[model samples]
Target: MKATPITLLVCALGGEGGGVLTEWLVEAARLAGFPAQATSIPGVAQRTGATTYYIELFPVLQSQLCGRQPVFSLSPVPGALDALVSSELLETARQIGNGMTSPERTRVLTSSARLLTTQERMQMSDGRRDPAELLKLVRAFSREHQVFDMNAVARECGTVVSAVLLGAIAGSGLFPIERRFYEEAVRGGVPHEKANASAQASLRGFAKAFEIVSQRQTQADFVSQVLKAQAMDSRLRGNDAGADGNDGRATALSVIPAEAGIHGFPPPVREFASLGYVRLADYQGRSYADLYTRRLRQVLDAETAADPQAANGHAITRETARWLALWMAFDDIVRVADLKSRASRHDRVLREVKAGEDDLVKVFDHFKPGVPEFAALLPSSLAQKLVAWDRRRIAAGKEPWAMPLKIGTHTAAGMLALRTLAAMKALRPRGSRFAFEQKMIERWLDGVVQGTKRGWALGHEVAHCGRLIKGYGATNERGKDNLLHVLDHLAVLPETEAATHAIAEARAAALADDAGQALDATLVRHGAPKREPKPQPIRFMRRPVPRESMDERRA
Candidate 1:
């Protein structure tokens, strides 16, 4: 309805230069002898902020009318938007979902790469959002749209992404301004040669987007063909015929890794085995990696014998592949030391902090290791003695003791200390905590094996319960308790409800809350009793008698 003012709505994550991009557009419009205004609402970094910038430009042919001026709104009118530029695929769809863009009017410019929302990444299971859904909405909303990997374009030019977005706006050609105005806006204060590289990347992004728009119809047809092919492939592979989703046995068997020593097994088994081997190898050493392979081999043998036809695509091995690898490479003090001491970790830290070539960087690691962490390294008898001492201290109105270590990992001696501790991975199996975790893993694996003999669905549920036993220290202990409780309590239920849905419901409940309240509610729903609250205790503190004054002692 407001034809005189061209409106653009930009939706971007924090630090992708949304405000800078808006500034560039405003400058370009003004440079071309047009009246323009831009404003932005600040947003939080990553996924959770309200960062939207709005711009309105009114074309003025001449400066003849001194008294006349144009009015522009600070925010975009939802259905009247002329352009929508988004840094992410989902955000593009989100704006459209909000009815900000009309199919008949707006041109959509978006990057297809995903940084994934925090919510998507934090799920207890595979939490990635599907890209396919966004692609469909991209087509439905924009009258003329261009989608490409803008991040790659920016990287190629060795510059930030604001220039690339500016280039995209110029290429859209909705405005009558020459490209040089946009280029001048960038290269004004900077040198021509240095600025041209940025200008070129911006222009390249613009041209790429324009081409996509021109050939969009053909692109849509190709997408349709790809979709049909995928559907046919899924049918042939029997991906959707069962409850395991697109992860069918045949498909899993078809994507075997080319890694050595796993060729004897089928594709699915080889895939997971290779991953477990690599993970454990990195977490510990070649010997431990071999141990993981041997365990996987046992599961593979059982799976092959029990389900020779490979129903559920050797789902048992698939589940073991994930949980077993995670369980075997449990986090510990030794593992922390190993990670921190690695040269690769040092290099990564340097890169993250963006240290200069001549800058001297010092890194200090702070650790407050209490009795438990210390006990993991000592012999059982020594560990018990140390724990008893801490208990005695606590009983005498003192806090449980901890040795706070300010490890200067930046210094030669500090780095060496950590590296020595890292080298103790060979002695890890003898540690009390390691032995305890290994026993727990063995029990979980046994449950999986038993579930498989009873039913694949039940086995799958049990294997998935490995998600319950995660994290280090207290969290790990709580997860272990939940897993064992479920196994013990649910084993009594009939195979039908317990295996098919109740187990999954219980697992969901466990993940729903950190305090185990949701898990208790779920357990109660499934005929298990609610957990009783622990009894509270109060103790009186006795202060030490003050020493008598010198004068009083003399008297």
Candidate 2:
């Protein structure tokens, strides 16, 4: 029988340089005098799916083929891959789910990093897939696996993730090609002028990945070593945690700086409360943070009175702590401007683009604020008139009024504008949106407290309803409506397992779909009235007759 070619598959999202990595692998194979072939299937878009590159290399050198060319497959067959490399955790699980991996054959190399998929982002609640489950899937299917944060390594080396992936593949020893061929391939792939610098950065990423994969036998051990190496290297560069007065450790919640003034709550509730306290403090001020804690304490007391034994471990209060903080810090133009103009944000942009310290980077922030955004900050009477006027315009088939702004955040003028807008946070409390949000928050909080008095499960379900109150503008408004509907219809129902289950189902339905159709169905099933549909503009447009039809009519 003819010698079989070794099959390898690479999976990466758009702009992560999957194509460059594929070219490098093929070029390395060529440099090693091995006959290689490669093919790729492009994915729909970034995060929807990963583009997969399939390669087949005749294990034997071309010089030894005696002019007999071995055939290669354009795509990988299920359970036949020798190696599978992926840049994302979920995409790795996706490949395994396709039955492309085998315990006896495939060596999987994947990054622990995740880019949330469109499906994950669409859910109203926490829609992320469990990383642990994805990792378990990877481990169960592969003969061997080396999983680490390739994106982190790339950032550290100031190179693309493709370099790190190439290094990991080289270190895995799946290919018969030597390491030098791979290095030469990376160098050859780039152009001149900054070739040496580019090659150095790529090599740094390659070496870091190569060392991590080659030295450690397990993922945990590899990660530990990598962290230790980072620590040591940072110390050498005089940038250690001591230099910044932070060890980058969070082994215990009590050690968190946010724990200040959050003393009386139970452990579970305290953890979330501490985080919430810190977030609210940053979003508004210490007084606003105090207000959040005070509200949380009220829920805790209610939960404690209901379940003195702490059987549920303050589950209601814990959930409330998280969602309450987020609700209180509702996004406004001020928040956006503050975030855009922050020094840390500028530094993060520079780092993400791999800009050197001396590199000049220009950052522009685009915004389109409609009448509604402006009306949010106006007094109630004025805001109502403004919004009504805009609605009237929409009803008249005219587009609602909005101003599109493009600000160069890197320039002095842009910085001034953003800071000036950010300074308007002092005026946020007097705004119509703030008053409306506070009223809704009070309603939700009251439901949580009263539901706890009724039953623990009922209270917990009510607490989870807080998740529906998220996003901004119409999405935010829809979430609040859904939450209020649940509070009014379900929270008042007699405390029972059935009532609690109905509340849970309602919340799930609301999160499952954005249009609220599923939620309406659930509400009707539970004997609650479905939401009243809002009035929609019914405009009839006049269809123009075709020229041929008009001419025939004239004739």
- Report the number of the highest-lDDT candidate: 2
Query: Where is the poorest 10-residue window by lDDT in model 2?
Result: 249-258
The Cα error of candidate 1 at residue 300, in Å, is 3.6
Residue pair clashes in candidate 2? none
Q: What would the TM-score be for candidate 1 when compared with the true structure?
A: 0.75
Clashing pairs in model 1, backbone N/Cα/C closer than 3 A: 249-313
* Candidate 2: stretches off by over 4 Å: 1-6, 30-39, 42-49, 56-75, 176-178, 189-194, 218-258, 351-361, 381-385, 388-399, 537-555
TM-scores for all candidates? Answer: 0.75, 0.83
Per-residue CA lDDT of candidate 1, range 267-320, in tens?
766767788788888887788887777777776776776688997798888778
lDDT of 2: 0.89
